[model samples]
Target chain A: MTEWEMVVGLEVHCELATATKLFCACPNAFGDEPNTNVCPVCLGLPGSLPVLNRHAVELAMRVGLALHCSVEPSIFHRKNYFYPDMPKDYQISQYDEPLNVGGRLDLPDGTRVGVTRAHLEEDTGKTTHVGGGGGRIHGADHSLVDYNRAGVPLVEIVSEPDIRSAEQAKAYVNELRAILVAIGASDARMEEGSLRIDANVSMRRAGAEVYGTRAEIKNLNSVRSLGRALEYEVRRQVGRLEAGEAVVQETRHWNEDEGRTSSMRSKEEAYDYRYFPEPDLVALAPSAEWLAGVRAVLPVLPSERRVDLARVAGVAETDAAVAAVVQQGLDGLVTAAVGAGADGRLALNRAANELAHATPPDAGAFAKVLRMEADGRLTATQAKGVLAELVSAGGDPEAIAAAKGFEALEGDVVAGAVDAAIAAHPGEWERYAGGEAKLAGFFVGKVMAATAGKADGKAVTALLRERLAGR
Target chain B: MALISRDDVAHVARLARLDLTEAELDQFAGQLAAVLEHAADVAALDTAGVPPTAHPFELVNVLRDDVAGPCLDRDEVLAMAPAAEDGRFRVPRILGEAP
Candidate 1:
């Protein structure tokens, strides 16, 4: 009902894609039988020492650099808290020294979101509250806990209240997800609970000097939910301010179904989580050489890849944006395609729009198919076919295309198909003669379909025009 | 004196759903107090222009080739659920309905 300025910040917890847990040999995996993938180290059993997974640290470093963060030479800490989900009772997390500090991520809207800190921590187990006949945990019989995910490597990236709107929050997550994927750090899958987001939302009157009290939205799993939660919280705060009431400091639950945020509990102001130097692990100062090595392997950021694809690949902005959306390195995809003798522009189109469209939901796998197509052995059409095959039957694009008799056609055979198609389609031939120039697309389609896309598209287009002109 | 009192420890323990005894509560109060006291030095660092660290690693994305593969079997993933009344995972009555 009233105008307000929303101030938003985010704490994003992304699970690193390392084979082992952050501090244990237990596999860092989901979909495993509960407790099957866990061990004494992850269970926080006594006498179990923690071992730092170097790969996780490298991934954290890689992510920091992609976000333009100044990677510290060293960082480590402990966050103390007792919970049923945490086997150790205290989570081994960075308090003062984190993997990355002070970074900025550019959104497509041309806004830069400031990153406050990205630190590494082990994940706690999952808890399921059981309530009895009353249907509430207040008088519940007991609770169920699953420790399979405990001690999993996690990097918490905190943003400096730079976000303004729900869209901005969503954009931040998307961009961050892109960067994480580029670095091969984490899967960044929200549904599998590999990536989680918590938001701090506060609103002040249009002219208010100091910021309003903030409410923290706990345990938001998806970027869309993160955006919706922030939007609802901002309105709720503004309503309170208009009614001559102050925004209460508390933790809230995002009722996604209701599209609103409800207070869960009064917020805790700096209650001490007894953080200490983890005695099991010492200060791990990353060497500059180690960082340089990681840098060499660093995939280009989505934004930089977009520009590179636009320039070298000569792709349109919309096409480049599609590749950026999947966070697949545009240059890499283009290079691979060109190596396979496919044109850069053609590869970009297939990678960005065509493959992106057919991917349906698995953006990760779609990007992979685009890469395979770039190698030139598979036609874009065949790549699409492989994508469909992958969607149904389980096989690589080359293997699938090869089995389906959809390999790319080379020189003479492609030329032969072009000649044959022009000779066959005559009525459409009359349409092209009448200055219906768009009919060229129809001929190209017919030739390509007849040849099964084995012919070079450019060669077909050029030959079709020459023959049509003679007619 | 520990900065984390029994009341504070108990309250946080309750929030996180940790059922601790009086003896463990007192022990945690002392341990937590010691830990926070050590962290007090974080304020002393002169960060005038120094940005707060968020991520220590580089920001490059590790991309997967856009190809689909077999994902976890639904039954295999959900088999170890503490409570499974149906195809979906079930737990004690939840604190609040999913949003």
Candidate 2:
């Protein structure tokens, strides 16, 4: 394959985590019954005007500030188009003027990607096509528009064409998602439609000064798909260029199952949204005090949290374990465990290995579990058992371990079990002591069986070593 | 200048989902050109120091607190739709796919 460098830019839209919709007082929630959250303003009824949701603006501002963007005065514009998903004939979004402009995202490898702008917009309703080819829009019998999500607030972050590879694009999104969730601006769930990505990919010869014509891949829902789609698009463009075919600039759809992209619409069919200033809404001029307030309450960001984890958890800065804990949102559990006098490494290990799940135990209870494991009251396997029990039935970790007969055995009891195993199997013990190190595991198993598996394997091993030395 | 052509009108009509005849497309082309001509006159003005105006009024930060308020009844809201099913607005089979 000829050497080529890919140029990629991302447009990420994240729904703001707010209590109500962007323009109306309807509840801004997910998975509710269809159209139950709609109001006149959200439904775009005649004679109805929008009142901007203050929390949405604040959340958008929070996201911008967290990304190191300068907040400025912004205005809303009516992007006129006709779509059934949009209850109104147009969508209210930001145009030339946006709330924040000019930011940068620093990936893990220290490459900084510049953010062109991050602006606020309202999400359109969802359309579920029925009675088609596997429920697709083509050849569908009809479509249903649920207005519950029509007026939800969204912040569309546009990046500069500085990404060189698909991995970089994925890292940029992961870091951005962390910041959004850390600051409570958005849930940033990719599986749900709360966070959506559009990738514009182009390729050129190595060391080229100018970029090639780009194709925009729309609706890359997952992070994996985002990277895969970019990779496939780059290869497609490169193939076209190598085969003496010109790459056409258009919108493409990523068929995830087929692992390829097909053209959705050509450039000529692009909708020229006649955008004009929204007359009903006013300018969003965030004052100095308001900006300061939002900034002051901003939580510790993901990068800072990773540093803290490295320092507290005693993990290497480049350790994948530290990144996994932080990325999985298990940093709080680690923090609580360390604060409760648990060993940092042990706490991080337990949390990363055991507590990494969709619903982890509360931080306080998880801290107790880690502290117990640290104090040697519970062995590693016992700690895992306690964690599982705690998840299914919330209770004290120590008590759960005790109920499961996982308590640490006394030294004398373990010694007694070792003695019984030795007395019962003297020939095996003699052979084990006769230069067969692997037989130590056999003896340990015998002792565990003698004690009904209550003896710590380590303690049993220690007792067996001493008895064999005396022999 | 013939800024708005008949083809442009037809494209715009297609985007707007308007089913217009050939005569209507031609007529709308001339009318839209007149509108654009008036907009061009306004754009030709020398207003270097003037900032862009998003709204005619000088109001800023007209926002409402994020509070839950009463919503219209589902039945009442669905009653106004031309076609509704399962408490949602039903429409013709959509041809375009979501992006």
Candidate 3:
């Protein structure tokens, strides 16, 4: 049997976070009353012209810089097509001269995906097929058009066909989303349709160098859908090849509910978008000074934040816990805690697991709690309780601990409890003293109960081992 | 010889949803051929250093701030539409999904 490999490329469309539409003053907002945001330019009325928005270009350039792309002089072209969603019967987009030419994104797993181009374009309006069953256009009576989303500025980032697996595709999208949010480019929310993905997938023999006919999958709403769609499409192509059938090149729609991809259209039906330079707008040649200004303001990206956190926390950069903390933007809190003399591993564990749920607390206050745990003033259980309170209600960590009676039990009291636990569990104690290391947990549980969960498990283990060695 | 054939004209008319008569397709093909010949004459010039022009003006980066202004009245806009329902423009049954 011949092994097969899947080759994938992605095109991600991210809506720019701008106050106005791309070419007009109409508000660039989502979910406004139908047609409420329409202006003459956006509505494609006669004698209306489009003026490029400066901030939109800057935001698009920021994305390019974050992805390590070179910003170049570009111009817009009218991608002519006949679709009701685009009131102008065409879309203004970057064609031959795109803004950002070559870039690359490094995923958390150290996979560097090459980006081909990220260009500026205007978004089309939304259409709802009302009279069809399930709102599909197949059987619909008529379609209703909403121009609220029309003329919104978008940056379509096209990636090279470097992704070889479904997991890489998902990772590429995740890292791209993080970069977008970090650079204040877009919200990057898949659910809100702010960020959209279309994948081109093909299956070839594992060792073959040449490419195979590819199918482009659309309507992947989330990262999970992108993965599933690629997997399904690859399997379907492999099945066809095994049965002596050639894989037809086409555009497939990913049905999330059905978990399969169905043919939408083929290459023969593809629209010939007669692209011509948009004459209404002038060429965009951003000065070198302005490019430097955008580069200066780019924030610390997620990958750097993960590496920094992992370095300070003494964990591997590929650690799942490290990724979680960085994804939730809690790495700063963990780093600050480590800087305040708290144990690195403990601070990271707590921040990734517990702090992820609650509102972020002051870094200093959080570090103080971990410091108490490290100094044996509070057990792990008691320290967790204190951290919870610190997150919920703001106060000095010591005061919160003392008011909750989490002051460590006197040494004598702990000793007494340890003695009582040994006495109560003679069989377990004898086995433990006789070098049954697993019996240590039994004694720790008893001491914890006796001290009302205040006793530190680590301290209990230490005392047990010492006593056993002495015996 | 004409640069554009009648069949080419027919194809473009179909794409644009224009129901042109057979005679019109032939007429427009000849007319479009003349226009292409003129463009070809210009393309034949040898001005090696001259850059291609996209617009008449020499201006670049003509831009506006990202501030929104007032929108047109939705009611008046919808009133002009041939069909309007539920605060949106109602068009005939779309042939296929948007590309």
Give model 3's DockQ, 2 decimals.
0.81
lDDT of 3 by residue, B1-99 (tens): 889989888888987889999889988999999999988997788979999888898899999999989999999999989999899999999986568
Runs in model 2 lying further than 4 Å from the true structure: A267-271, A313-316, A330-351, A358-471, B1-14, B17-45
DockQ for candidate 1, please give it. 0.07
Model 2 native-contact share: 0.86
Superior candidate under TM-score, 2 versus 3 = 3
Taken over the whole model, the C-alpha lDDT of each candidate is 0.71, 0.87, 0.91
Q: Model 2, residue A359: displacement in angstroms?
A: 8.6
List of clashing residue pairs for candidate 3? none
How many clashes in each candidate? 51, 0, 0
Model 1 residue B53 CA deviation (Å) reads 20
Pitting candidate 1 against candidate 2, the one with the higher TM-score is: 2
Top candidate by DockQ = 3
Q: Stretches of candidate 1 above 4 Å error? A: A132-139, A207-209, A312-355, A359-471, B1-99
Error of 2 at A127 (Å): 1.3
Question: What value does the lDDT take at residue A211 in candidate 1?
Answer: 80
For model 1, how does the per-residue alpha-carbon lDDT over A1-471 read when each residue is reduced to its tens digit?
Answer: 446888889999999888777876666779876666666677665797776777888888888888888888554566765455675668888877777999988876667889998888888887655655433345666566667788888889999988888987898898888778767988889999988988998987666778889888986878878877887787788788888998888888776777887777776444456556665565666678888998899866677766655666565544535445345444565555556555566556655554444434244454556665665556656777776777666655556777888666666777777677667877777778778888878877887788765655666778767776777
lDDT of 2 at B72: 84
